[model samples]
Target: MPKGFQAMTPHAAPPISVEGLRRSFRGPDGRPFDAVAGLTFRIETPGTIVSLIGPDGAGKTTLLRLLAGILTPDAGEVRLFGRRPDTNDPEFVATLGFMPQRFGLYEELTVWENFKIFGALRGVEGAALETRFRDLMTLSGLKGFEEREAGKLSGGMKQKLGLSCALLSEPKLLLLDEPTVGVDPLSRRELWRILEAMRTRTGMTVLVSTAYLEEAARTDRTMLLSKGRLLAEDAPDALAQTTAGRGWRARALKDAEEARLARALMHDVRAASDSPAAAPWLDAVPHGEYVDLLTAADHTRSGTPPRLATDAPEAHLEPRAPTLEDAYCALTFPETRAVHAALAAPARRTDPPAPTRTAGNPLNAQDVQDAVVAEGISRRFGAFTAVADTSFRVRRGEIFGLLGPNGAGKTTTFRMLCGLLAPSGGRISVAGVDLRTARSAARAKVGYVAQKFSLYAQLSGRENLEYFGGCFGVSGRALRERIDELTAGGELARRLDARVGELPLGAKRELALACALIHRPEILFLDEATSGADVCARRAFWRRIVDLARAGTTVVVTTHFMEEAEYCDRFLIQDAGRVLALGTPLEVRRRAGAASVEEAFARIVTDARRRNAEGFAS
Candidate 1:
């Protein structure tokens, strides 16, 4: 920004301020668990979006709950509208809206009915609520389907309705605990749009917790958390600026393909690691680079600086433009590569053990695949088609993803596949077992992690896992062995006896996964499983899933994080219950023809919208 432009920036007193807040929970053995040591922050405006970000075990959710007065802080104070958060003032609580990580909507009630109860709880009724209800349904794209039972709604739809409940009263302060967790990319985008629109119109004070850096980018300011500590806090633009001039994209170089060279220098680093998990390309630093750099003979490389000859001809340097991703990586993991290098057993990539791919006839693609084939699947509530003519296949051992905006057919598809809902139109077969015909057997062979942690929180983590294992037919010695393997020496095990509800969001997520995988199902379905956990937790969860897949588990996942598409062996992009595109990571990226999965997704969605528009015009 120019000097004059900087002068135009707004400066106002914070609408909410927190000082030295801390929280702790008692362990099963009566030990006090210090979750949040100390946290302090201030939000200046009602309209601004403030994000609390951190790795697993960070105090983000604890702090948010404390501010919402849902949980009492062990120490210090949180003030909203200059009053203590625990004021017990109905007017004060009414001025604030809080959405928990696990929302408490009545699954048995219709979407509109659930919203009505929540609105009534907040003291809004009659005509005023009717107006708000209409507005929220439109904002959520559930206008025609409000009469549909919440239990019958898709995961994304449930989340949207949860958001709508929070917004019905037009609270001055909004606390959203990972509101977009199980939503598809398209749905996430719509949610962002609604939040932005709400912000622009009401100047509402919005605070959110997220594991995604992309979501953080949407916030006016963000606080990075790690292990119950605050690492850094700053405006998005300022944080991005710190990584200026240090990032690039590089592909292979060929003699005849010189013309394809872009501004970034191309090189081959044989010694460098190449793991999808670590993103070797994105994380590569030039300190130990070995390459054949561009010379005066290569005019194809764009914006090349003048080169000078030296005694050694092995190295050439190029100035590259840094991106927000690069900046975020650099700031968060400045010596990440160096730290990895210091370790003697450093692998170049985040490669898991090789997958134990089952033996099957390659020519018989349709046979022996651990897949969910949903044919002619359709769900209807009254006159609305939540899912119509939806059909798809999730291949064996492939990390298949469902991508779409919110209120689309993603959740409906998942339910049909899992036999949670009998489709109005068709059939779902899992690993050759038809769900509608053999629901129990089909379900037993499938492991699922819901968008929200479904394990009982009041119970111990270990108990939850063991109980879930039993539900899936694993019991006695086998269950014990599996539990030991999942929990032993792992962080999940270390927190074994801890009450599930008392654990951090990340730990809760890990426990949920442990439960899902307890039965060693051939098919796994994760519905936005990593939505609200910290970055470290998200990383940990992905690592575990990759491990599970390598062990021959067929994983089907739904996520709002576009970057995760790179992890999928193949992915299907959906918008409004229709499959827009489907292919491998590279294929999808190439089809979208963009730098990263995030960019490709944006471009693909835009193209999809354009095509829809033109078709309608015709």
Candidate 2:
């Protein structure tokens, strides 16, 4: 064990114990709704890792705040170390470290300065503080970058820095809320290693909430919540075993056909069942180039399983081991199916209106032309080159993806494409207007949704839509019509009048998309649109994007979730301002000699970095 954590020891009581907890908040309609309702659970072990998971609005955040003593429960009891928690108690506060979804780090300060300040505020100072800070920097891989400003750090580095600051006090109990939401896969692995190392060395307890089920499966225990109640709690492997012999993988499926196959399978299952109890499949969801199907117990026992109706000679089905995600879907499919049915209505615009040119732009709207063109584009700041000699073409109505690790210049390239930043060199044309000559006119033909929330928090959803519509030259009856078309009979329609600040994370994401689409531009850009969303929400969001692309809207997107890269017609991968690979998903995987996009991405980036280091040494 390291000397820094040697002073820590396991507590006598379990880390957390809750009994009949309940909390409520008023809705926009002025009615009370339970956020955390009548929940009971206990963590019986003192030095174990536990994962809390659920869909949006499942009260995961509320429950975490309650356990951390940041919020008071309206009904029952919450105990820490066998005693009720009091936030005002210094000793109690010293024993706990809570990193909320947004850690309050001083953006203007240097990384080292931020750590020193946080440590001193927690009563660690002088040489003792210096030793602890060095240990944390080494653990977080931020040792050589101490002078970097916090505001300028990459997404992964910022998250690592936040984790380091949270550990300065050496709290026995750590609460992390979605710590890896927007982080890259490599950084996520590093964060988990740090957590595991801490637990193994010092016997500290960790309670983390995550949107990624794969992360949850690594923990000692998993607790699944839904609508403020605990639906299931058990070891992940044991939970997965409950769905044994029912999981199947579909082979020989194509990207464009996967969605249609899933929908068809759902429809056939519903039609084949005369009664609710006669359904043959629980759910069918697209997983990359294949589908993951959860067969009904009775269907599997009867020696017959569902099959796809396709002419492909190699199409086949094979049994696969169940996973934590399979268990989660099995437990929640009935309720989720109903909610999805309600939300999927507005996104089913298969024959949407054709693209129209923005007023004052002379470009002809055609499906065959290249929607975005860049030739040897580069951007440099002071002595550093952010993007260098990059070139790509995006076909109209195509789904093009921009992919890279944090600080790899993907955002810089995206900003140049959007005409938000002028390139330092090279030629670029967007929507047939030369970006150098008419940046504003080119911007008028494209709609962009940023990586972070960019809407008015205090205004209602309808008001924000109205505000953005007017900015795009839409007005009065036309603006109202656009809003109606965007929200009619969908999830947004139900939350239309709610303040943007008060809605759930998924709802907020959808509203941002609506605001961006108000102008009906020829092209759309989405940056990490579903970074913090649950699996169901991501599927729904992609469905909308797919339909839009089918209806002649050119789409460019950037996401950290590698699985989402499969949805792109073609994608470009870059690192350190240079292109690594650019091709279809199949071509990229073949070039990298990997079976999946995630694996290909890792292999590509690792190989590039290794080659660069070797060249430098030579």
Best by lDDT: 2
Clashes of 1: 7
Which ranges in model 2 have alpha carbons more than 4 Å from their true place? 1-12, 253-289, 295-303, 307-314, 334-339, 346-368, 472-482
Off by over 4 Å in 1: 1-13, 45-47, 86-97, 102-172, 240-366, 369-397, 415-484, 497-505, 512-523, 547-553, 575-578, 589-618
lDDT, candidate 1, 442-551, per-residue tens: 68777888987788988999899878988888899999988876554344556788888777555676677778878777788898887755443343355455545545
Worst 10 residues of 2 by lDDT: 343-352
Cα error, residue 19 of model 1, in Å, equals: 2.4
Q: Rate the local accuracy (lDDT) of all candidates.
A: 0.65, 0.78
TM-score of model 1 (CA atoms): 0.68
Alpha-carbon TM-score of each model against the true structure = 0.68, 0.87
